[model samples]
Target chain A: MNDFVYKWRNPIFGSVSVVLFFLGWEALLTWAIPLNPFIMSKPSLIFEGLWLEMQSGQLWSDLLISGQPFIFGFGAAIVVGIFVGTMMGWRARVGYALDPLLTALYASPLVAIAPLVIIFFGVGVSGKAILIFVLCVFPFVFNTYAGVKSVDRLLVNVVRSLGGNERDIYLKVIVPSVLPFIIAGARYAIGRALVGILVGEFFAATAGIGYRIAWFSDMFELSRMFGYILVMMVVAVLFTEGIRWAERAAFPWRVGM
Target chain B: MNDTTSTAVSPVPASAAPVRDEGLGEITRRTFWEANERHALGIGFIVFVLLLWEVIPHILTLSRGMDLFFTTPTQVAMTLYNMFASGEIWPAFKFSAVAFSVGLGLSIVAALPLGVIIGRSHTMNAMLDPFITAFNATPRLVFLPIILVWFGIGMWSVVVVVFIGAVFPLLINTYAGVRNADRLLINVVRSFGASEWQINKLVILPNSMPFIIAGLRLAIGRAILGIVVAEFFGGSSEGIGVMMNDAAGKFQVDIVFAGLVIFMALSLVMVGGVKVLEARLSRWRPENVKSF
Candidate 1:
């Protein structure tokens, strides 16, 4: 429990745990245990396969392929979600009117019905973007709606009492307070959009990480499949970590937000 | 108000005992479903939307051939009725249900203890934070290919996907709930010679109940998503997802819509039912700033 020891203890322990996990993964595949490597390929093999894929230039193209759909879909979700959410929050009637529809969609497995989307948008970038849009938009809208609704009424009252106009109240008080929630919403939206791209690619697509993953999995190339998954996870982690860092940088005064 | 202020410490005070609105739970659930009870306008709005779904397609079909892409509500209802009559929907529904329940059960079992450990000790949190965060952020769909390879194309793989989908929200919420347990309460219990286990049992667990329930609500949504996705891509070829996919492939838009209705019903039942249950469980718990 010493303060000095505690500072380094966790990081060291984390590193040790990760190393132990990889070691186990490596050791599990045999030369010793007879559990098919084709099924559960070792970490070294996976990385090596990934390295080979990298050199073949497949990884870069897949990244670019998935990246465009991700950006457009996620960007649209942010723009439209915040607008609709804020509007719903600002007007009680709008919220009530939309509640039944939104709630149904929220509860249902809309993602599973990707084929229906294909019928509408066709199997193009537009279709993929629409898929991502549907998947990612809800979190942002809900968060922004909650953010707006939960804004301190007392603060608004104080602003109005001080002769603040509607524009001033919105810009200075509402927007500032709601910004953190928007960013938080965007964070979740990123993951949802990622799934949209992957799922979209999985069903119908030409070039993407998900397409490669499916292709490898089908061919029984477990190592390459694992490699792609590893890369996918790394990209996801970096995106999430980036968002979290941005949250801190943006809201320096707000702790544990 | 003036009289109450003057009688601040009255002997044998009539207001000594707290009163609860027992009907409040049912009333609030009704409010959520009906929005406001002023004139049953929310119910009207819902009905209107359903009617529109039926009417619009009919209008379009009357003018041109539009039913191929999207079907009317009557067709969907009839398809649903026929599917049930033929006993086709049951097997798939049962399969998906098993996956959902098993996955959710496993997630709760695994996450509760882990969440408590990481939450109770800052050291554990700091050590495991990176791994947990990274896993949570990564789409659970990514694990599908791995699970399929490891578990093979079966219910086990589907269950694994559900577990991955649901576990994080549960774990993170439980952790937050534990961390945010009142320090003053902990100190008070400690002063009274309460052990760590006692504190956790009597104080921490109850304090965290609402958070856990909220997490469960979120986890159900994720689990539903997981089950459907797992069925589609993880290779089991038999669940509601499979049935929907088959319908979609066959251009049975009505059947697909029927399946969508079923999914909606299941979702509503799970989430709405759980929200009511959470409300009931935490009825006696004191209110604080909701971390959710």
Candidate 2:
């Protein structure tokens, strides 16, 4: 019994804790303090709402709509950010000129400008993509720049002594060194991009998970709103875990770092 | 070989030294320029961009239609000055400042003790880890709608949003710090007949100072974002975000820009303040150990 308990401790404890939490929530709502259903939803109600939405295929459509901006924005950010970051890292002049501007943008609440962005690009996929791009791009740029700055000087010298040219050094040394940083930046960008998507959709969007959430909340469909939030939570966890898994696969040695 | 390598790696061009026979005054000037080159270039670049921003609308005749969406830097500056000079910004600033401080303070109070407890106890950590992970992964904005419903749309809702945004980072970092505290030191304290409370007070809290400060730095940005976003969505009419939203609705682009500048400045000051605190508090730590 002790051996079995030890073997299954994590799973056993984890499940018990989750189950207990849900049960307690349900019990509190049902018996202890019966609040208005619309104000505070129970786990059962949320699940039921989720199931209904899933069956109606609204959830899938919302997911698809939201995924487009995220994919396009994140994809563009990676390409542009890496390119810009490489330029900045390679040339001290470029880095010096751009650092302050980038720092200001990174630190500021860029979401406040969502309305202006919508005005520029219209309330469409492009606008959302652009917003997400702006939100996600900075992390990549900063990380890649730092990674390049921290590249082993000795390695570069060794490459040069071996008659390697700039292109060879970049392709063989710089790219590999910076790949981990790029991955790490992508991890940061995932959360930022999600926030961007939500803010964009909240501000002005016809279709998307965020729009649905706003719609549900406006309509006082609290359970449905909770359902959508659950979906967002799941997506966030999946995306973050996926990136972490990729990072581990790519650079096993840099796990803790 | 050393000379060649040094010259090759040096940022200063060798030709600059040789092309002009420099006097003491010239050498001093050049050295000063070199020392502050990054700052000079950065400021110069900003000035160049601002000039372009001021000129482009006029040059392209975009001031007629596009000016509603995009304003020149001078216009933004003027609007910012007017907001302050006329005392229009003070109420909004006060509203946001109160919410931010209260929310962040509450988070610090709640998270610090809970984080220490969770970090110290295996059973508590095991039980609570999954819930913390889920909540942390979930964007705090998703809770805004429910919070608004529960708390009713006002300063309290905004405070709740800021609290949620700011709490997880601090909690997680504090937990990490406590876990990463020198086990050897704890054992040493134990051997000296120190209790767990004494050990935690003496060794663990001090060891975790850098991590906690880093967490606070991250939390400040999130908390600021929370303030803006919560005010934007919560229908609070008395914060910077509400002012910006109102301006946006009116197509007062300059006012929106001014508000954004204020937020940026606020973030910079808070983060900078925390960094100074971190530096002062962690003076005893080795350089390598203080990186976090």
Most TM-score-accurate candidate: 2
Per-residue lDDT over B168-283 for candidate 2, one digit per residue giving the tens place of the 0 to 100 score: 99999999999999999999999999998899899999998898999999999999999989998854768999999988889999998999999999999989999999999989
lDDT of 1 by residue, A91-203 (tens): 75666566667767867878876888876688888999999999889888888877777676666667889998888788987898889999888888888888898889889
lDDT of 1 by residue, B250-283 (tens): 8888877887888889888989898888878877
Off by over 4 Å in 1: A1-5, A27-35, A152-167, B1-41, B61-66, B183-199, B289-292
lDDT of 1 at B174: 95
Candidate 2 regions with alpha-carbon error over 4 angstroms:
A1-12, A159-168, B1-30
Query: lDDT tens string, model 2, A93-207?
Result: 7889999989988999998888788888988899999999999999999998888776766677789899999898888877888899999998889889989989988888888
Q: What is the lDDT of candidate 1?
A: 0.83
lDDT minimum window of 10 residues, candidate 1 chain B: B1-10
Give the candidate number with the greatest DockQ. 2
Error of 1 at A60 (Å): 1.2
